[model samples]
Target: MSTVAVIGASGLLGRALVRELGTCAGWRIVPTAYRRVQGDTVALDIRDAAAVAAFVERVRPDAIVLAAAERRPDVCQHDPAAARALNVDAVRTVASAARQCGAWVLSISTDYVFDGSAPPYRIDDPPAPLNAYGLSKLDGERALLQSNPFGCVLRLPLLYGPVLDWSESAVTSLVPAVVASQAAGARPAPMDAWATRYPTYTPDVAYVIRAMLEQHAKGQAVCGIAQWSGDEPMTKFDIAVRIARALSIDARLEAQTASADATPRPRDCHLDSSQLDALGIGRRTPFDVAIGEVLSAWPAPTPSS
Candidate 1:
């Protein structure tokens, strides 16, 4: 049976990857977590290059998925050192370790690498990151490829799915604001209506990764750059509206026509998922249906004392 080592198994997409690959026949999963290591999840700090190397030698899986990163845009802008530590340095560490152990690596990346001036970004499009987070991810992508010939980069757009809390994802985080706005005499909640986002489902991404792994097992490892994303585009206001609808609550949500985020964001960096589409490696759950599934598990807030 072939084995795959998944780093950052405690995070949103990482959990989904583990859950998806766990069901596949003839596969063994070695999941690692840094902050919340528990159960079968191994404790690993990717930033510690020596420890990472040691871990790789011990596990020696056939493939590795590097999913750990400091993804917050504002945080990245404020603390670039930390972002680089995880997104870039840690990526290099993982790729190097994987290469030495004869394992291929798949590193996660973001569409923010582009300036969002263009629509339907292809794999070949020149990246022009506007913020620290995007820049770090772009650098990390380069680091992975540079460190390992067998490494691949999968760039994704904004994501949402099974979340620990509404704050865990941008799409789900609007729930609190939506609920608060519905209260009598409450002020309208302002939401960004400028930047468009594609809230791809994490489980669907896990499914695609499993397909790539299946291909790798067949001696057809996917290398270099590839991308996958949800087809639907919606702004924060749009998503909030849907959340309100799902809850059957009429909420006051104001559309912010102009950009308000302190950190610079691209207007529409909609990644053209043609590469994965060509390989028939993709899954898309409609926003309405998928959002409902996410919200169902979330218990309503307790009333104020």
Candidate 2:
């Protein structure tokens, strides 16, 4: 049984990691939380260097998976400084600490690192992020690589999954809203004409992380800049329609709003997992299948308190 400390284990990817790893490898998952949650919760504030170091030293985990980040695009745009503090600086502290402890760190990253000028971007493609959130994640990736030679950065795309139960984003908010709207016979507005992006299921990503950990432990020469995402590419509009369709709702109720009318989004944030496929490292889940799984896994929403 390996000792893995999954920071932000309460988040989407974190929860999936705990659930998947808990059952498979008998991994003693120490799910760190700033607020609180079940199982070995720790008051870990990644931004605090001394505190981060202290947590790492005390835990002495064999592997550290840093999934904590300020993932909100609008919020990052509103406050780039805060985004940097949490996304980049905090990640640096954790990576540095993990390096000192000789623990392999796999920092969860984003596809937004690219400017989205191209589609199906390969791992070797140069990144030119168009948004603050993307920039911060890019910074985190660079910092981790430079800080620790053994560190791995797994870049991801638009993510969706069961963890939406606690998420505050529109993706998370929209599912329940759409379900309610359909239940109420009202059409919920869905944003169409937004950029095309690769949407990755959180559970599939968790599996890839476990695979990476297993491979890395065996001292394999795995690429650090690996991309983990769905098999096919689709726009937000398409994603919304699919989600509605999965629920057997009139997907037409999903409105088509343009990117101009919505928040800042990359025009083409789709990534290429071919490199991962070539190396036999990353796992690919079909987008449609992923949507069905996500919807199926979503717990029945309750009335607002």
**lDDT on C-alpha atoms for all candidate structures:** 0.92, 0.77
TM-score of 2: 0.89
Candidate 1, residue 16: how far the Cα is off, in Å: 0.6
User: Candidate 1 residues 237-305, lDDT tens each?
Assistant: 999999889888888999999999999999999998887888888889899999889888866442120
TM-score of 1: 0.98
Cand. 1 Cα-lDDT: 0.92
lDDT of 2 by residue, 22-42 (tens): 877557778887765665677
- List the lowest-lDDT window of 10 residues for candidate 2: 296-305
TM-score list, all predictions = 0.98, 0.89
What candidate 2 gets wrong by more than 4 Å, as runs, is 164-170, 180-188, 221-223, 254-257, 261-263, 298-305
